[model samples]
Target: MNHNLLLDSIAKHIHLDEEETALFLSFIQPKKVRKKQYLLLEGEVNRFGMFVTSGCLRSYNLDENGFQYIQQFAPEGWWMGDMYSLITQEPGHLYIDALFDSELLLISKTNLERLYKEVPKFNYYFRILAEKSLVSYQTRAMENLRLTAKERYEKFCLRYPTLVDCLSQKQVAAYIGVTPEFLSKMLHSEPELKP
Candidate 1:
């Protein structure tokens, strides 16, 4: 993965001087994970906020019944982390794994704090990010309560068209809160949306 991708991503959100950018890059530790490999597991502290440079990852939790509920999928240029665990330094409920062989840039909580102190603009950027994340979480929760399964599937497609093909139908169904068979029926009924 090109370092420029990380540089470009930061530049899009906030202006960074050369020195600031260098400092930012210095703290980044690049990691590669093969498909089905975990970057983090349940009961582990989420030490790093990860940026996907290539491929995809999913953050999910398994219920008592062993059913997986996916909270988020991070594709190229996206960030993924357990905010609660990162903030509290406690074990997280989610398991984060690569869906495909992936390259990532990780910034540990300690390094992130250092960055926030050294480059105060970074605090503003992260605050904006947190606000957007909260909005998305609230919207998802509302949709789960208010929308029908078919409606949720449609909205999921509209919002994450790339992921529709990138992920398995089963994974998509899990994310949208429906059984695979039900999602199949819904997709079949809407032939235009079926892949």
Candidate 2:
């Protein structure tokens, strides 16, 4: 499997030697997922952290009324997983699925721990990743409570500029916490939101 992207990601935080890189790569397994395929479902324990090589994936939770509230979108070059379940090894509340046919490199929790031991620098890399993920989640939570729907839409656009043209209006609405009709209306009323 091609791992240039994954290696580049790792290189951003740590310098891995050839041996270290090979050992790290040996621990990960590559998998292909079809569009709309579920990588993880609610009530199932999440065992792997996935790095997207191509396409996109989304994680969402279902409310009591069965409405979906999207938590995140992992496009190419990003990492994603059910963090709570991966850490605690318990059933997760989120459902993770591919938005397009995708390739991923998956590292299981067991193997990840082994990686940390084998390549201690990975601990620092993962710590940085966890901190960034936590901050993003916290910021989104605050934005949901404090920002207007239009402002939230703007934030979504700013955050995922590459995604705007490719994603469906319904998916965009889900991320910005609005109904698809509401999003369409807002876009129509404010031409500036078209971007």
Candidate 3:
């Protein structure tokens, strides 16, 4: 399997020597997931952190009425996991699934801890990633509270430009926190807003 993408992502944050790179590679377990396949389900403890090598994955939760609310999308070159469950080893509330047939590199919690001790620099890399994730979540939360559905859709389009045309309208509606019909009306009313 091609590891170049993952290695390149790591290189951006930490310079790993040949031996170090090999060690890191040794910790990864490759996985392939078909579209709509569940990588994780509600109440399951997440044992691995996944790095998307190809295609897309999404994490979402369903409400009592069975409406889905998407939390995040991990496209190629992105990392994803239920941080709460991964760190605490407790059940997670979200469900994670492949949005398209995908390839991933998974590092189990045990291996991740070993890497932190063995390479130490990985601590810095993960800290940066966590900080950025936190910032993005905070920004999205604030926007949800303040922005209109149309504005949120615009932001979603900007954030996941690659997904705009590829995702189903229902999926887009879920992410933007609007009903499909509402999104449809908004798009039709504002022709320029169509992604």
Candidate 4:
């Protein structure tokens, strides 16, 4: 695995000197997850915040009826975790799983705090991540309310072409808030839906 991918991603946001970078890397624990493996399950406390170095991971929830609703997809360079659980040290409702065999760099909450205190600049990087996450969730909520199924699919295709190709049609339909059957019809109806 390319451990430098995590370092490069951090460097993009903050200036880390050699010693600081080494210290940061020391705090990260590299993990490999198999496809379909659960990194976190509903009701489990999230011990670490994860950075995807390769392959895909997804955060989702299951309804009472056992239907899946995808909250987010984390491809390479993306981060995943339940912030509420990590912050409060409580069990989380979200389920996180590897959609494909994946490599990750994980930092525990304690280590993250130490990194903030030692490096300081990581605070800014995490802040930007949180802000972007907020914007993404807000946009998704708005799109669900305002956009048609086809429009949502179009926007999704534009935003996450990689995911559209990597994920199954049913998974894409769940993310876009449509039944797989309906999404199939919509896709067949439009040539542009082939993302």
Candidate 5:
């Protein structure tokens, strides 16, 4: 495994000693999620909080009508998991799956807590990460309520430029809460809007 990118990733938030870093890195297992694979299923505990190294993932909810509503997308450098399920050991309301073949780093709850004990300030690091998650989802909801469909699609595309290359059109439409056909038209016809 290339330890540089992973170390650089963690160092951006908090520097770890060689020992602590080694222990932390030992806990992060690299895995590949095949295309159309489910990392998490609804009604199951989230065993690992995943970090994307490449490719993309989506978290969605299936309704009684069997319609899937996409909640969030995770691309490279993003974190994806059912935070509630991982924290509480309760069944998750969401299903997390890969949009394409993915290179992921998996960290379990046990090791994360172990890091908190070992590294002292690791809890603070995770807290900040969680806060970002909260704010991002909150902002996304706000944007959905406040912006037009075209506006929301534009914002999503701008925010994740490599997304189209990494994810399918179906997944992109799911992220923006639009049909694939609509996303296609919007992509071609709509003028760009500044964020």
Candidate 6:
């Protein structure tokens, strides 16, 4: 299961001795999703935080015009869920769905808070994680709105080389705020994208 990978990731910021580690590990359950399945829907409250072990998932918002804007994609070793829904127990603002069949290590919100209480360092870890996520997404948002197609494609490839190969052109284009055909042209013209 390579539990060490998960353990190491968390331990870097938060440490758990033998007893606390056991309790924390006990609540994390294995979850799986078939392709095209929903981890969460826009109107449902999210109760769990998912850590991807394999495959791909995306969060998107459907607009009044029925357009889907891909807000984020979490592949292996990434955390996912609707933060607003999880924290507030309100309806999720985005839909979280499986882009590929997936396996996840999950922790319920109840257990998550319990873990935080049992291990105060975990609270600090979460704070760090939240801040980093916000900053990274803010940078991505700025780039999408301000950069040229070639520049954005270059940045995307540089930043997410792993995910770039897994996603469809249409999906990547949506994330980058461009049409699929436009993304294709950029890919061909840009040496970084061309093999």
In order, candidate lDDTs are 0.91, 0.93, 0.95, 0.90, 0.81, 0.85
Better TM-score candidate (3, 6): 3
What candidate 6 gets wrong by more than 4 Å, as runs, is 188-193
Per-model TM-score versus the true fold: 0.96, 0.97, 0.98, 0.95, 0.87, 0.91
Ranking by lDDT: 3, 2, 1, 4, 6, 5
Model 3 C-alpha lDDT per residue in residues 89-148, reported as the tens digit of each score: 999999999999999999999999999999999999999989999999999999999999
Best by lDDT: 3
Tens digit of per-residue lDDT, candidate 6, span 1-195? 546657877888876789888888898998889999998888999999988888889999888977778888999878998989999988888999999999888899999988888887888888998999999989988887899977877787788898888888888887777778888887777656754
Clash pairs, candidate 3, are: none
Error of 1 at 79 (Å): 0.4
**Per-candidate clash tally:** 0, 0, 0, 0, 0, 0
Off by over 4 Å in 1: none
> Which of the two, 2 or 5, has more lDDT?
2
How well does candidate 3 score on lDDT at residue 54?
A: 96
Candidate 4 local Cα displacement, residue 60, angstroms = 0.1
Per-residue lDDT of candidate 5, residues 1-195 (tens digit): 555666776788887888888888888898888988999899999989888888888899887977677887887777889988998989889999987888988889888778778788777777888898789889998998999888787777777886656567677777777778887787677555322
| Superposed model 3: Cα runs more than 4 Å off | none
Candidate with better lDDT, 1 vs 2: 2
Compare candidates 4 and 5 on TM-score and give the better one. Answer: 4
| Residue 44, candidate 2: alpha-carbon lDDT | 98
